[model samples]
Target: MNVRPAEPMFVSVPPRPQRLLHSEAYIKYIEGLQADSKYISNWDKQLRANTENTPVPDQSRLPTHWLGNGAGNHGSVVNALWMLRDFMMKDALGINKTI
Candidate 1:
């Protein structure tokens, strides 16, 4: 009887529900935000200040949570979406590397 070596097998892995949010659509959304005039202005200001060695704001003394008119709540939703997008991109890179 001859013994044969086992061949490596590739398995298709499905993304979790949360990770499904990270897709091309999400990347486009982020790009859209970057394209907004207000967002660009704010980002440019921050970058310029950082390059000029401006003192950092004292965020350590700020309140962790503030009760506001639904703005904060909406911010949380946006944050979750971004998180999902990041997760999905990372997962994609990992899959690409394995292949």
Candidate 2:
């Protein structure tokens, strides 16, 4: 009796080319928007407000674990499954924590 190697079960197809909206004119239009004084002033005001208004929370005062009635407790199974999928995908792709 002779044994044969298993054949491939699926064929790989090349991905379709992506059409990006980064033409020269579009880039120039974006650059013009960035250079506009009103846009610059709005962004500057937003940045200043964001930096000045918000205060960082004290991490030491935060809860160490999820509460029994919290959203995490309700979706614990879903979260565990998602974590498993992510771990498997990372292991398969050889990705590190930094990635």
Candidate 3:
């Protein structure tokens, strides 16, 4: 049985693009949220500046209640802060990789 060279088939497969979160509508929503008084903060301002001229999608900011509650609990906040600092140092600065 002879297979006639697969008939030189031309497959027109479209490329599957990655779905990035940074769309124009999403960017507009982020800008609007940044302008809102309830969510605006120094960090938010900085983030707005950084993201304004770029295409990076911003993560949700920590809520005000979280900050207030964390501040109200001294020991827990301290522990959590230290843990976060260490985590950032390790993951960002590549200090510790024992995970």
lDDT of 1 by residue, 4-99 (tens): 998769777997676446666578666767543665334454334421365424545333344233234446533443444456657875997889
In terms of TM-score, how similar is model 1 to the real structure? Answer: 0.26
Q: Return the number of clashes found in candidate 3.
A: 0
TM-score of each: 0.26, 0.23, 0.22
Task: Name the weakest run of 10 consecutive residues (lDDT summed) in model 1.
Answer: 62-71
Give per-model CA RMSD.
18.0, 17.7, 13.4
Instruction: Using TM-score as the measure, name the better of candidate 1 and candidate 3.
Output: 1
Q: How many collisions between residues are there in candidate 2?
A: 0
After superposing all C-alphas onto the true structure, candidate 2 shows an RMSD in angstroms of 17.7
Give one digit per residue, the lDDT tens place, for model 2 in 47-99: 34432364435544434343344335436533443444456655865766547
